[model samples]
Target: MAAPAHTFTHDGIAFGGDYNPEQWHPSVWEEDVALMREAGVDLVAINIFGWAAVEPRSGEFTFASLDRVIELLHAAGIRVNLGTGTASPPAWLTLAHPEILPIAEDGTTRYPGGRQAWCPSSPAFRTAALSLVRAVAERFGSHPAVALWHVSNELGCHNALCYCDQSAAAFRRWLRARYNSIDALNAAWGTAFWSQTYSDWDEILPPRAALSARNPGQALDFHRFSSDELLDYYRAEAAVIRDLSDVPVTTNFMVAAHIENMDYWQWAGEMDVVANDHYLDYRLGDPRTELSFAADLSRGLALGSPWLLMEHSTGAVNWQPINFAKSPGQMLRNSLTHVARGADAVCFFQWRASLQGSEKFHSAMLPHAGTDSELWREVVELGAILSKLDEVAGSRVVADIALVFSWESWWAADAESRPSTAIGYLDQVHAVYAAFAALHMTMDVVAPGADLSEYKLVVVPGLHLVRNEEAAIINDWIADGGTALVTFFSGIVDENDRVWAGGYTGPFRDALGVAVEEFAPLAPDSRVSLDSGATGTKWSERMRVTTAEVVDAFADGPAAGSPAITRNRWGSGNAWYLSTLLEPEEYRSLALQLAAEAGVDSPVRVSGDAEGAVEVVRRRGDLASYVFAINHSNTSVQLQVSGTELITGDNNAGHNTAGHNTAGDNTVATVEVPPGAVRIIREESAS
Candidate 1:
């Protein structure tokens, strides 16, 4: 449990990034502040990795250096998002209590060379870590410059899973609390098979390395337990901060690529503001499509309330195999694209580049080239743009489509020994989402069992694990005139990791009006043909349609001439099922057809020629609406809109159609967006 959600205290559209003054001399701190002021940086994050500096020894206290840094920002009228600075524990404390170190899943100890090297369930580490948290909160809790309290830096980033004795005990304790007794635990874990039955709670252990294969139920429960442990840790820290300060508190969520340990659906309610750190992942088919999905996911976590973009890179990140810098205007589009979704604030991972560290290569607001660099100039330009769009703060993006996402499902479906290694949980998710994005549609990434009544359309893909009640929610909604699209390989297992009885689709089979006889996952580099002239890759299914209309059939594959896609008229609305992965363009065609059937339209549509090259979204408040046009193409895009463009502060002058202005407002006119540019139009209030 956490404190009731508090207010986001920063002024309109807070802008800044992580600032580390300790990495440089006292002389350099002044220059950093001056440059920050020049770039319109108002809110700065400081002391993210200050555990070693704040408390050099176990009990010693030192705030002299941090105090000076904060003082300089305060004097310049900049606010602070104070970090608890417990990201990494000091060397002395870990050396004294070696048991606090984390053990890998293979039973190897993890030393302190990297960040977050301690066990999440270790008592010694918690005590030392919380003491440092308390000290920092007590000292800076009342400072006027401190508006937000940033908890640890990206919790559960590296050491989410631990297999030490201490962690094993904690896992057992968590299980006990959930199942209540040894008998119940044994039943839930399905230990009656494989001679693995347990008579006492003490006999159970964390699912460590096994010879053949571990129990599926036990592995799933351990994942649940690990996520709960981190949530418990965050609750403890939040409790401490609320006891000491009145400012809002948050921890940066890695909602971006490759890190999916923590179940943020369970963690979002504990936060006052849902802040996320995103870096463009070039490994995906298209990074921009994934970016839109991630941003919508963050907005969903915030429940459509304005959230924060805690950290993004200015150009490129250091960690990817091949680091690539953004093009000339890529940073601007990236930052504003997040804003267009639902971010009230725009921030980055760093304010200045590091001279000596592992992340020194990461891009920053002030790069090594100093003021003369284009990156620095763009940072200043972004700040100015944010300042001009002050009225856009607190507005929320509206979406009629819901895409269901689950961290637990990702863990279970992507576990070892699935039907195919050619396809992954995220691969299908990103595929479907990119299809919608290409149509310039905005979707709210939702969780299963969430209220689907508010949405006109819902998309559920690759959901391998679901509760009975969660499936019921979707079925009930579909019967009430809400259009639903459920893809293949979903609803296979229940919460206990047991197969659902009737068919592969489980509880959803009746709603979708289709059931799978068996899975026909294709081999590597294999492709199949569809009757609709679309190509299917990576996956195919052998299924029979019962009470449905066949939309497409497999022309040639393992299940030749079978139904590939079907639509069923359930009660008041419709339910559609797609049993194979379609190529990108074909997927988009299917998705657009469904969206049109559901009567869900984009906020503003682009011309046919610029359909896939431009994205438009609207943020609406009671008094006004802001339309954001992002041009990803190299040619100019002209959109029909009626308002004053905020970026250039020009009214619709010559682009207005004659006699369209008779109603006395800036008539619907063509707004020419330059190649690789953005235009925000402030229009009249919503009726």
Candidate 2:
């Protein structure tokens, strides 16, 4: 695969945000360019929503505005992440071809007023969209300012699952390719239960609105087909770019809390460089933990390589029901945290805040207040800070633990007929990840069936759907001495959405040495006590012991006196099973106990008059190693290390936050980390 576009002049972290000069007049363009220079902005994305602008009429094309914007940025030494402008369709095309509009699951047409309103299977839309892509690529493919080819802006964000007739035809074609024949598809879909058997390909349809609960097998396949369709569309756009340009190609992946539409692992191999757009979703509290999880996940999609943060927010975002602006240094803290986890570039959703449109109130690098605001000051300071860590680019994050993240599990667990409405796959993953975060442990987020050989410890939480081979790999790894933590609702089904037959914990029963007799999903806001003196919520299971030792049992609830937690000595290593979701603190305590057994350790520790938490992560390169200490609290803390501090540019410019201490590579080197400050240390081997 090709490397990511590294176009900044100083060889430092790439900086800047989405820039739309067409939204303003040429008079404002000069000022915007000057401000970009003043803030040290080196990268800016243009023509992201250029579908309507570039091709205003069906066959008519205009490059006057786009050409001028690129010329201005190029003149100012800013490299471009150019968009193909197929993000959304223009009003004329949709009016001319109404069949291209997407249909909701409830059989409603998603109009073209919003972005991403076209159906993925519509040939009319694809032809028009691909034509626009070709026009953009042909015009600017060899342009000096163009550093990267952005295919489409956030594909599948608005229309992943469409129930139109075209989608049904496309679904049948995809099914034929996967299952090969009608008999094979029937076996996989388990159609006999509801008299839903298909005699031929044409008989099958996209799982549309139903009288009762939809078929799990059908629903699961539709989700898979939807993700595949979007990936296929992206591949087509990428093909156009590759034929015309050598610039690395990428489209921003919505790998955030609200999106689970795309199985990004399948799409990773197709990208030249993986990029992601992330925003703070207040629905999931503790923005710090949520931010780390998202950044780490983006890295995971890149296969642990350095990735670009294509979109974040400077302050409040406009989409959320209750948007909250970042408090004080939060903007800086959020940017650095992404860097701490291995983001080589930091960019936000926009450069200038919009004056009109759905995103009008969305914060940007340059707010509506222009350069006079404190937001602009913070943006400039962040730009300077990023420039100081030039050498930190291209380094890989260090991790010893692996967390299995499966989109299949997410799809299956979230369907309508699950045991509990509260057993959310992402929620469970976040809850378990928060446990690791509480212990200040950095972990690798891996997909199902990933090699566990490199990791000392593996964490599997809420893995509701596991293929036979995936289960076998984990079983083999554990028997070969890899420690693991497998939680509830895991190993329940195979690739076909069919049960594993023997017990609740299906293919994992042998490795886990425990049998889940039945699922006992609890009521909402419910609680159950465990023998370990910890309270559990969300779910509990009736289980029996085989070779596994019962570590904790239920004290009350449906499965009273049953095992709540189990530990099995499988071969040379250990496998622990959690039957219920424990409170955050208790979960972290148990995770630490397992970590101690696995010999996982972090060199850094934090304790002081600190008011908030400090996230510690390290990146390793052949020539140098660096530690990132990000303080997210209210009071200052001390980071003692023997290295050169990048921000202050001293031999060891440690902090005096804990009263006072010298900063040196030898003894007495203490760096005081002010609350909500970021410190990067280039370490010495001798220390």
Candidate 3:
């Protein structure tokens, strides 16, 4: 496959963050550029939120100040990812065209003080946004400093859904285009039960309250429409950029977990390169795992291409409650974690700390404490380290396993009504991914309908919504000697959130040799013991075994002594069905067992006695394999490997002790990984 255009410059990884010079004084621009060059910054994202400063009045354009900032950075040998500055429109446009403002689900008009306040489907909004995009592209298409065309800042981060009359009209048009006729729509929506049938397209409205229960099909379609509406806005801007400039155009994507509103699997096709903005959710006990989840999904969307880490927090963020700060060396570790997962670039949210704004408390490269601060010193050190490891860029992560993920399933699973309110779609995905991570195994988090011929083991976790075509694809792969793991709550609904006719598990019932008759969601704080000495919690299904071998049975519960885990031989391979949420250790063991059955193993293993968590990821280059060992626990751990330590520039020999050898002929070596530390080792032998 061909690589995306304008992803990098000078054959090195882009190492700078967002640069908003318009927020600072003119005198600060020179110093900012100098500081950037001093820190080995080669690319800077500028004008991300400069709409008010660029065009103060309607139909007016001014680029003098931004031109100076671009020129200064260009003279300093830095390339630019120039933004269209359409994220937050000027007050004049919002005040003149109030219809452009988005309406909340509660029927309140969102004001202009906040960003992303424009309704996506409003004709006035689209007209003004596309106009600004054209002007920006025409002005900077051929600028010497411009290397990338940033379409918009974090599309649909807020206000992804609008229930205004304008959006309602757009939704109706979208529904008509999809279903074609009212009869077909009524059948798909099951409107006869509630007397909500529509004879005309105009009768259909955006999903709203005042009903006992909103139509699940209507809500699902609205979610899809909202995603498409935002995508259309992006495509309109990308069209202008593509016509005016050869530079690659992209918009940074938000978290993958909350992408039920916008299906990125469809949106990624329109972009030149994939870029993502991820912030650590401090509320989670372990945020690094969430980081891996996001990065893996980002890389999957890139389809093995190198993606850009557009924006991340250097330390504390201003948005989250409590705004926890990073400990020593944690920032560097977090950035490298993304790199290990396949990010070609590592950049933060801003270059300098804001003096007066909502994000003033947010940490940046140059923090509020200035150059003498520890964060600034660590930032410089990370930059210097990244300068020497350019080989890590453009390398793809090779995994023996893949987990199926779907935005459609996520949307339908999280509807207002379901088998159980506690069954979260992404939560189950994260649980399975984390289980594999705990076993030091690497995996590709991919779409459910993605091609599965390359992987040995494919895992589908809690996919409540499954389509017939998707089921056929998986069944075909399994018949072709591929192993699969389908968990509880899967194969329950089709694309329209309608359950299959035969029973739950849909097409998978035959493949797994099991049928789910009823759901048995446990009460809060309840648990069921498994025959494998593990506990199950949250939810369980009443499953009956047919031809499959029961792997584990419930020890005690309403469905005691029943099949909790079963394996069925189908064609040349086997399919496993998990009927309950297993404990973390049991889940890891079972996942590893299935992986072993599929002839897959970890690339690296911990030897001797290690008392902490050591996560390993391997990325393959043309010449060597880069093995990244990250210690997530507070205690130090020892790892045995054969590689040249890239960070310390040490070419160690095989079977040597940590920090004690200099030869490169040994087949194994040991390294003492510090607490909360990261080590990248370049293997002596090629992968």
RMSDs, each prediction?
A: 2.4, 2.8, 2.7
TM-scores, all candidates, are 0.97, 0.96, 0.96
Single out the weakest 10-residue window by summed lDDT for candidate 1: 653-662
State the TM-score for model 1.
0.97
Best by lDDT: 1
List where candidate 2 sits over 4 angstroms from the true fold: 1-10, 609-612, 654-670
Query: lDDT score of model 1?
Result: 0.88
**lDDT (tens digit, per residue) of candidate 2 on 25-130:** 7789888889999998998988999888899999888999889889989999999999999999999999999999999988998997889889999999999998
lDDT of 1 at 518: 90
User: Which portions of model 1 miss their true places by more than 4 Å?
Assistant: 1-3, 653-668, 685-687
Instruction: Give the per-residue lDDT of model 1 (tens digit) for 241-356.
Output: 88999999999999976997899999998999999999999987789978888999999999888899999999999989999999999999999999999998899989989998
Query: Cα RMSD (Å) between model 2 and the true structure?
Result: 2.8
Position 448, candidate 3: lDDT: 69
CA lDDT of every candidate: 0.88, 0.87, 0.84
Model 3, position 316: C-alpha lDDT score: 96
